[model samples]
Target: MKLARAIHFDESDMRVYASPARTGEWCISGGFEFSNWTEGDLTGKPRQAFANGWLGLETFGRATFVAVTALEPAELEALTDLLAEHFVTYYGAPSAEAARPVAQEEIGQMVELCEDHAPNTLLTVARELTESGVREAYRVIESSDAGLDQFAIHGSLDDEPHHH
Candidate 1:
């Protein structure tokens, strides 16, 4: 399967990349940059500039990763809808009740694997959680004690001396 990532940096720029995880594996997907606009500036009703567009394209078979500086309540809802669309597109259909168990199981397996080997790479852990068919699994792991420990260990490793 072809994996794509759309990262929204702040409220100004949107970086869309395809297969950014691997080296020398570039794809035709390019990034989309957005201009910054205040609540009142967008539609004159206090709305996000990219909310509609982002939510509209969420139903396709694309994996989007949003990284915003600040997220509001309305924006959260929009993001949730986008995630739901992503799940439905990637999996089969939209059924949170049915997807929850599978998502949880995938997250559990990711936790176990990270604890066993790559305990010093939280980003790797997060990526693994995402790739394991569990959308937003990082949020669950981030809220767990084990996940916090793993993050600390990963941080410590980053601060350690490099022998290579």
Candidate 2:
């Protein structure tokens, strides 16, 4: 099966996200985090996350990019359990048992989304609060169409107090 994993190209995510997802962790849309948010909440780091962030399953944190990858059944089940626990602990779900199905549904949506894309393809999400509610859109960049440079900056810079 196919799924997505968080990938970081730079330290920008650390600065922009209140909680940044660890690189190489599994990820999903995670839009549920913003369900209760209002226009007034859309400022600063939270705004950056709403603009573009993938919810990392392990850390329950935000990621800027996620690349398509393979998924094993065991891993899926574990992710579901983690999410269910999160719902109970954070979202006030009655119990883990009661939250299981909803967690499965959320992960299932991501699985369905990745099913059609090739492995290693990069995915990005953009969300906005509209008159009615939140609106989400996705952008896909196939591996063949993009390279590492597009996502990250390499090399180093030295500050020798050079004068120009």
Candidate 3:
């Protein structure tokens, strides 16, 4: 998905950081960046546009990991896994193997996997994005879900992160 070069953040204090858009992991960039954000938080409906069934993740402070993104619960979950898999893919098998493999068949295990991998995935994404350049980083992180691109943050989503 494509986005305006100038990313709009709801929070006045939010900042932008750069990270490279690498191959094999590019598919997970959108979600990974949003999930691994350090300087900001996430806000939902009635506040930042989640009322439309789309969630937003915004950046905060003078240094930001991700600016903002609006996505569905399903897409969030899917992207969570994608980020995890990307973690495993980039970091090799040892670390990922230690984090518990994603059990695709069992809903319960899947939930657990998401819980377990979120932190690691975020860290991994953050590390990679550190040198990717804000413009390219934000550009790639516009949307993870196909057909659901182009979202705006009318308010701050970088103060607190939440789960739907």
Candidate 4:
């Protein structure tokens, strides 16, 4: 696929392509590429498919992320919200619970744990930034196929995680 944009975040490297799949849809796919996790490796990623399934992505992964239900242009926002909500329900610890009273050493270990786990990093990235990322992407898409190659890297969160 011709990569239109690439987002290199804390634990994930996502590339958004100007999809040749469908007009109003996006092609979301990627995975935990254990063997080759480098600067420009697409091996471990998922095959480019339309945004019409429970996209459980993993380049080197979210388990059943990016739902295809009720999909629309607004679905991007809805997907981000649903992902956050799912995290709140299943992710064990919500981002709101991040400010727990703990020893400095414990903080260090948790940080290390996240660093060691790609899924953990993905979750953290999801918690921190998915909504804004989707919004930005939609903005570009709405601008037209001409606005296809707008790549980006998100190294920080724009706001606190949402819960419900």
What TM-score, computed on C-alpha atoms, does each candidate reach?
Answer: 0.27, 0.89, 0.25, 0.20
* Native-to-model Cα distance after best TM-score fit, residue 123 in candidate 1, in Å: 10
Model 4 / residue 152 / CA error / Å:
28
When sorted by TM-score, best at the front, the candidate numbers are 2, 1, 3, 4
After best superposition, candidate 4 residue 134: deviation in angstroms? 24
Top candidate by lDDT: 2
lDDT of each residue in 9-101, candidate 1, tens digit only: 132323232212221111111111123333344342112222322222332311222211222446434434544444455666557555545
TM-score pick, better of 1 and 4: 1
Q: How many clashes does the backbone of model 3 have?
A: 11
Best by TM-score: 2
lDDT of 3 by residue, 1-164 (tens): 21111222333212112222211121222332243433234343211211111111121111222222223467545544554454466545455344234412222322332342211121112222244432221222323321112222322344455443
10 residues in a row with least lDDT, candidate 4: 134-143
User: Per-residue lDDT for 1-164 in model 4, tens only?
Assistant: 01111222232223432222221122133211112323233223332222211123112122222211122335444334443443445444455234132222232232333333222112111211132222111111221322212211222234444232
> What lDDT is reached at residue 26 by model 2?
93
- How much lDDT does candidate 4 score? 0.26
Candidate 2 lDDT over 54-128, as tens digits, reads 999889889999888889999999999999999999999999999999999999999999999988888999999
lDDT of each: 0.29, 0.87, 0.28, 0.26
Q: Where is the poorest 10-residue window by lDDT in model 3? A: 46-55
